[model samples]
Target chain A: MNRTRFLDSSRLTSALFWLSLVGIVTGLYAAFIYAPNEKTMGVVYRIFYFHVPSAWVAFLSFLVVFVGGIMYLRTRERRWDTLALSSAEIGVVFCAIALITGSIWGKPAWGTWWTWEPRLTTTLVLWLIYAAYLMLRRMIEEESQRARVAAVFGIVGFVDVPIVFMSIRWWRTVHPIVFTIDEIRIAPSMLAALLIALVAFTLFYLYLLIQRISLENVGHELEALKQRVA
Target chain B: MDGVKKALWIVWKDVVCELRTKETLSSMFVFALLAIVIFNFAFQLRGDERVGLIAPGVLWVAFTFAGVLGLNRSFIKEKDHGCLEGLMLCPVDRSAIYAGKALGNLAFMLLMEAIALPMFAVFFNLPVLMPSLLLVILLGTVGFAGVGTLFSAISVNTKAREVMLPILFFPVLIPIVIAAVKSTAQIFDGVSFDQSMPWINLMLAFDVIFLVVSFLSFEYVVEG
Candidate 1:
């Protein structure tokens, strides 16, 4: 809570920016050069390079919601709310990318742009649920009220994500769950590329999260400034 | 002695006021009836094939929308007259206030469903008045009210409260709706209780989870 500690946190932002640059470069190289063309879908399957990683990060965002929400409710600190909001926003972005890239990948693989198969449908539902969370935050004027209610929602909303994910496995669905890691069917080079992509995307997510937290801090400061001026 | 009596007194005051005015009940009943009518026209519920598959969805949809109306009114009256703040100032447990409000909202919703169910059966020419189906309706209503009351308290404080309640309520209530509709359909198909137990269990789970969650979170929501 010290002012110096708070100000020094900005250094982490620069570190993330540099790390993300390296990740993007490595991800692009692996996707285009290193990974082999998938036999069934051909070139378009390469979209998994970005698509799968984005999906992983989206789920990670909700994990932040769980931890940050619990802390906010327990400590009654505004910082935790800021962290939750940042994570939710980043989660939404990654979810959007996942949907779009999945669609792009689907066109060649599934021969259609869209289908209500469990994977796609559940992802769509996850998107709307978090979007509703952000909307609920906007609908409340008081910061404390917004934080408390949204934290409660963040916790409850996260419980649904796993259910949504499992709905595909539980019920019959058309979307195929390809690339089971344990199956070991994919080529070694392709697997290597995917590992690199995963690392890169995770670093990218960290970078985005830091940027968002900084922006939120600035917005909070601006609000405080306005209050003082008023 | 006085605190318990005062809280009970507030509960009675709300019930009597609602009885005399009947604003919540009438609005919810008429809204539910209209929703059923709209569904009837929209789906053309004449044939047996269409009616069987769509009946459960139509019934629950009506319940959800009508329940939203009831939830919105439950707090608006208290907030309008500043009775909520007065209630908060009392020495009684805040959970009592949540319980009383939720129970009142549950009563209004059940009343609306009671009217809607018979009308739905008559309109669709479906026999939904069976005991098993009625039991499913009652259990589903508990899950709905348990969560709806908590979210209503939260949403009523928001800027666009009327719109906010459904958005917040629906996603969290998805499990309930799915379980309710599945079980109702199973009963309508003449399935035995053993066949329907899983969905029933799921509904019970949802009710317990939300009831506990809402009870614990109610204080944070109602706090100034």
Candidate 2:
């Protein structure tokens, strides 16, 4: 019965995965073909579809990690630790995508590959902070000790992220205005395309999170079985 | 209240140990001094002409790197003598150990900063000994040490203790460093205190947030 239930869930996941694949293809088509080009940035502006959605999903992933951290601390459940670790790893990847896409968009838009603009700067710092989180997890050998310490870190690190954003925002204001994304008005079709991309990327993040968590569980079981045989 | 007093005792214990050994303080001070010297040569600044430009960056970089050295010692010393487990065994609130260690780390960082200030002034040929600059230094160090102490405890149990401290330290320290560097640069530029109030306020916010969060979370890090 348990095996049958597990297979049922696996079937659901596979169906959801296929649904997301379809959503992503549609999102791409809408982004590239449906959305009209801007007068200023031209065709290259299509990267915004990928850029903004990736950043949104990345932030969402970190939020999950933060909640998982708190849950782990409160309940001492190993499952929460698995969720936090997996989400953080995925978060780092999406954050890197946000950064790379932002840089690519910046190159033609601002004529520089990188700028110390507030959002980009904060995102880069966010990337570094979570990267450090993963590295900290790697350094600890004991399972429970690693979970507890990493939880504390995730909680404290999340609190600091807002302060970091604010400070960088203020710092940027004191300097000259390099370029402003605010000036670009989102046309209706562009907004539609952005919404499609957001939905698709969010589904993609959920799919990845589910897959990673199950893989971790399998790995945990394998470790246990190996120890039992030994 | 008992927790507060116990925490104070933790601070006193560290102070006495540090005074007798002076090892951590001396190393931190020397390391910071060397960094300042390196900065002086690295920038190749002539006189006070470029001192304002480079002084803040140089000062903060020195302080943070040196601050990590002191923070690492805060917990490692306890771990070395097995005092850490003993402290945990005590009936007192676990956070007292955190408070004590953070306060101790804060004091060492401030002392290093105090001594380094004169050297910084001497090397850059700038009068950076103002009361305002000291305020910025204190706020920045408190935030840095507050978070650093917690992470140091967490890092000490890790394999790569030395590398782990800075890796964990620098990223979370971005706000404090930014606020400190910006305000310190303004002070060196001879900007009045009021001009740097915004940055100072930001530092104050960072300090309070990290202090509360670290104090609350320290138990988990240390107990684990």
Candidate 3:
């Protein structure tokens, strides 16, 4: 009975699937048409369409990990642990896109592929910390122990993101804090484009998160089935 | 009254055990001294260039690396003899255990810092023994030991205990380290306390926030 419940997909999940399709199409359309060419760096600024949203979604996924971690530790529920792991795995995917897209954007803008500027360096460190969080989980063998340890780490690791982001502002750094709504003046079209992209990316992220959770639930059901057969 | 007494007993027991063995302290001291020696040899501190610039970085690096050793050992001794489980089995409140361990770790770290500060003055010909700089060290140590105690508990249970502590620790500690280094540098430059107050405030805030979070979350990490 529990196994069947686990395998069953919900209506919310299907809704997210359609939402994600809308998001991807609107996101690309806005990026290519609505957003204006950059005055300083033409053509390449289009990368911001994908790059910024990927990072935003990556950060959102980690926040899920943090909340899920706290819930797991509080309730000692295996489902929360599964949610935390699924979110972390998807978060890594977005983080990878953020890193790669940022690098690709960097090549044209900064005239160099990489510099140990504060923002870039801290983002790299953020990547390493979560990578280590996943590695820590893999190294532990016992299921309960893995969940416990990983939950603790997930909480600790997510708390560091704000610190990493602020390090550039606290310590003097060369990375320009662009796109501050207060600081930079932008045309209406550009703002509209960004808003559309933000909405689309958010939908896409929700879609991915739901899909991953569904797949994880299926895996858990399969394991239970095998256990029953045994 | 009984719970308070029991907590004090735990704290005192840790202190006396350290006094007798002196293992954690001795290794931390020696490790700190060696770190300074390595920095001196590597950087080749010339005449006036030494005093202001090197003092803050050297003290922090020494404290950070030495703190790692001290933090790892903080739990190893408890786990070795199964005392941690015994403590958990006690009726005393769990937060008391965290407070006791944090205080004990703080004392050990301060002792090492106390010794290292004077030695740093002698070795580098810097005036790090100043009262203001000492205040920065005190504030910095509070933040370090607060978070270190928590991460140590979490890391000690992991597979790669030693490596896991730093990887988990250093990122969360960046703010504290930055504040410590900045405040120390300000003091070294003879800046007034007002100039360095913001960094001090940041350190205090971090210490309070993490201290509370760690205290609340510690039970989860230790539960078998």
Candidate 4:
């Protein structure tokens, strides 16, 4: 908004860009070389490093959208709507990645490319909800109304995720439960590698979210300018 | 006016309109019947022992598809007739409009199911109209109309219009589909009523949650 804040934001973006790059490179090494092969599953278990973080970041981004939706409705701020839209797009991407990686892992681990496991079903439902959010955005022609309706959906869809998980879990769940309250149930090296990947993926998600929000702001300004000229 | 009174008035108006035109019920009923007929053909349901295995799923699928038709008409008619503005202008709470539309949709869905289920039973020779099944149907339809009414309002205003309703409605309605189908199967399996209680509870919970969320966020949807 002001000169110094603008400068600080630019500096922050570049710093995030470089940090994510470095973190991802380090994460790759950690996942591949630092972590020992899993005894039962061997190399197929390597996908877990990326799968867990993508899933985590996907859920994290939806939380951003959910919070943004509430704030947008309360404040009626353009920034909040922009934040929701941007996060939803990123969330969809990461959610898809999580699904694909998990499916690939399922083939080797379970001898099936897909299963109605609780976690898998929840992710798929979340993915469909995200798609609906984006589709809702695309279908509305009016800017403010679009934002309003989308925010409504964002809030409602995020709230439905737990209900979806619970209903499906009650139906069935054979997905491996790796983490518990007390310990993660893995070797220390594997845990360390997972931590690195999680941090790296999280940083990468932040960088993308900031970039997308700024891009949306620019698009809004351009639309305003075009209307004025016309 | 009070919300309930106002909502009932809206429902009264919609039901009268539906009664006069017979438009919404006809489309929904026809679609539902056709779905059952098709299901009968696909699954070969004549005196089959395994009908219980797949019948619940088939019944739910048919009903939900038909319910979407009923929901799509719930708001599209008001908006298309330019009556939505008048409804918005009324001093009543916008949630009155939501509750009214949702109630209207539920009525149409239930009526359609009442006929469709008996026809399905006769054609397939399955005993589907029991008391427990009726309760399951009521719970499922309430959740469908509750959430579907909000989506109906939102979707009818979108670029794709009525086509968007099912895309948005069905995915979020997964819990209802699962719980409803499972409960129906449980009933058919002659399981104890207590065993099916969780599934019934699930539909009841989804009904409450979606209805509250739809009520809270509804004003934003109708406001200009």
Highest lDDT model number: 2
Chain B TM-score of all predictions, in order? 0.94, 0.96, 0.95, 0.97
Per-model TM-score, in order, reads 0.91, 0.97, 0.89, 0.95
Off by over 4 Å in 3: A1-15, A112-122, A173-185, A225-230
Q: In model 1, what is the error at residue B102, expressed in angstroms? A: 1.5
- Model 1, global lDDT: 0.81
Write candidate 1's Cα lDDT for B57-176 as tens digits: 989999999999999988888789888899899887777788878777777888888888888888877887688888889889998898898889888889888888998888777767
Select the stronger candidate by lDDT from 1 and 2. Answer: 2
lDDT: worst 10-residue window of model 3 chain A? A176-185
How far residue B196's Cα lies from its native spot in candidate 3, in Å, is 1.1
Backbone clashes in model 2, listed as residue pairs:
none
Which lDDT tens digits does candidate 2 get at residues B1-224?
A: 99999989998999999999999999999999988878768877667576678778988999989888888888889989889999999999888888888888999999888898888877778887688988999899889988999999989989999889998878889999999999999888887889899999999999898899888988888874
Q: Once model 1 is optimally superposed onto the true structure by TM-score, how far is the C-alpha of residue A189 displaced, in angstroms?
A: 2.9
- Model 2: residue B91 alpha-carbon error in angstroms: 0.9
lDDT string for model 4 (B1-224, tens) is 59999999989999999999999899998998888888878878766767778888888999999999888878888887689998999989998888888888888899999989888787656888689989999999999989998988889779997778887877799999999988988888898989889889999999999999999898998888
Candidate 1 chain B, run of 10 with poorest lDDT? B1-10
Q: Model 4 compared with the native: what TM-score?
A: 0.95
Best by DockQ: 2
Q: Show the lowest summed lDDT stretch of 10 residues, model 4 chain A.
A: A1-10
User: Which should have the higher DockQ, number 1 or number 4?
Assistant: 4
Candidate 3 lDDT score relative to the true structure: 0.80
| A4-115: candidate 2 lDDT, tens digit per residue | 1122267767877998898899999999999999977889999999999989988898888899899899988788898899899999999999999999999999899999
